[model samples]
Target: MATHFHKKPNLYPAHVQLKVSDLARSIEYYTTIIGFKVLQRTGSEAYLTADGQTILVSLIEIQNAQPLQRGFAGLYHLALLLPSRKDLGNIVQHFVNLNIRLGAADHDVSEALYLNDPDGNGIEIYIDRDESEWTWFDDGQVNMVTEQLNFQPILTAADGNWTGLPAETVMGHVHLSVANLDKSEQFYTNVLDYNVVTRYGTQALFVSTGKYHHHFGLNTWNSNNGQAPEENMVGLKSVTIVLKDEHYAEEVKQSLNANGFIVENFAEAPAYGGAQLFSTVDPNGLRILFTLDGE
Candidate 1:
């Protein structure tokens, strides 16, 4: 995997928080199917880790939580980037052995498998091709296309051992179902300083920092002019973006303020090692937390 895309000097999604109806059931699915170990678990919350040190995904159980509502502005999927093609092959074989159905796609830039949790929250497991193979235009847009993934080569690359998620796995990107394409693009680009990397016509667009394929995919495919999901719904709770340092976080906060966006500050948790942290909502009402990388 490319370390620079996820590490400091480029803002990337570090973690994701999801709302589920049942903590126990969700934990089982994440641990068994997704190959994540429980990092910490409280009464109604569980933090999952693949490397045992960094938290990648968190689940919070809400009382009387409703099922994920379609046509709402929320998570389309939270992507987990694997370290290598062989790792991806192993997981594919594992899924095949377990008879778990998946949606596979080759986006020219990466090969991805899609599935949903027990709560219907989407999850994407993918492995990216080398940056050398990527195609970029002079217009600053990266070329990406959804094509049928040939599974034979990936299966051939597999060692047929399915232990669990590799330690190198990281939260790759987030795809969101938003209400308006233009507003979402403006907010992510102007406020968050992301550059548009690719566009799927008027229905969707991809944006990123440091010219990675995409860090976030904003789409209005099913949610055009739709409203945000209710708070108690089984869907995305928030997404965490890891900034390089406190200074960059402060600059983002200032940008949000200058744009008349409401910035909410929450107390720093010990888990973050006292890194500066704050949150703001996007134009689609998706909450985004910004924090400095504790490392």
Candidate 2:
């Protein structure tokens, strides 16, 4: 197990380097279609920042790497982390002004707004509540539930409009779609050691670390006994997980392997605090990477 290869200076975290099929098409869809702004770009890659979180959809124009398969364990959703509930409130106001209706839910630990990207990747914009406020069961399990999220306060002029968020926000969590909820929860929470935030019978489950709400979510929405995706469909390119320190990152990479998650390679991602990213293929064969936070 290795660690991040770059320097991390802040708490702002995100999953960077999403490999895509067509760089131009993805860039167009993110910028024009999904309303993301282009932060930077090189020969074949483009970095886009949305609501203050900087993410790079790196278009590796190579004849290698595992091809994407739909119907399999693709991205369940990409959560755009907000600074606070006030930050989320402003975003709600933005949607209100645009006459866009969004799905709101309180997962006991977080307040979230659910929507979709241009390519059908589920997107969740959210803010975490105080850790002390997170409930726990008598058996020591974290308790989470879907509740009503109040948006009226945010829509008021007094709260402020959340149009262009600053760069302090992040990608707090990455949710996934699996064939079975229990099985997925076992892999993430039990195997990976994330505390169980909660579960919804057989439909879905949520997990997190240090009771900071949910760092991961799993659901059996469209894929009960799910099938892997095809090579042509555009879905979750890859998910980057940021860790705290080089030692911690190194620890996680080894833990993943000991837990039976087959690791492909250990690469030097100096862009991510010099963290060593160990990519793994799940039962559904989705590529998930672990890296470090960005500045």
- Choose the strongest candidate by lDDT: 1
Candidate 1 TM-score, true structure as reference: 0.97
Question: What are the per-model numbers of colliding residue pairs?
Answer: 0, 21
Global lDDT for candidate 1? Answer: 0.90
Candidate 2's TM-score reads: 0.76
CA shift at 286, candidate 1, in angstroms? 1.0
Q: Which stretches of candidate 2 lie above 4 Å from their native place?
A: 1-13, 16-36, 50-71, 157-163, 246-250, 267-275, 292-295
Task: Residues 1-295, candidate 2: write the lDDT tens digits.
Answer: 0012112422222564454556777777556533466766777667777643355333332234355444467777777766666667666766667676578898767778888654456777777777668787876667777789776754552276444653555667778888767667766665555777567777877776655556677787777787765445556656665566778766766877788887766645544223546677666656667665444
**Model 1: CA > 4 A from native:** 270-276
lDDT of 1 by residue, 26-86 (tens): 9999999999999889888998999988888889999988887767999999999999999
Query: What is the Cα-based lDDT of residue 65 in candidate 2?
Result: 34
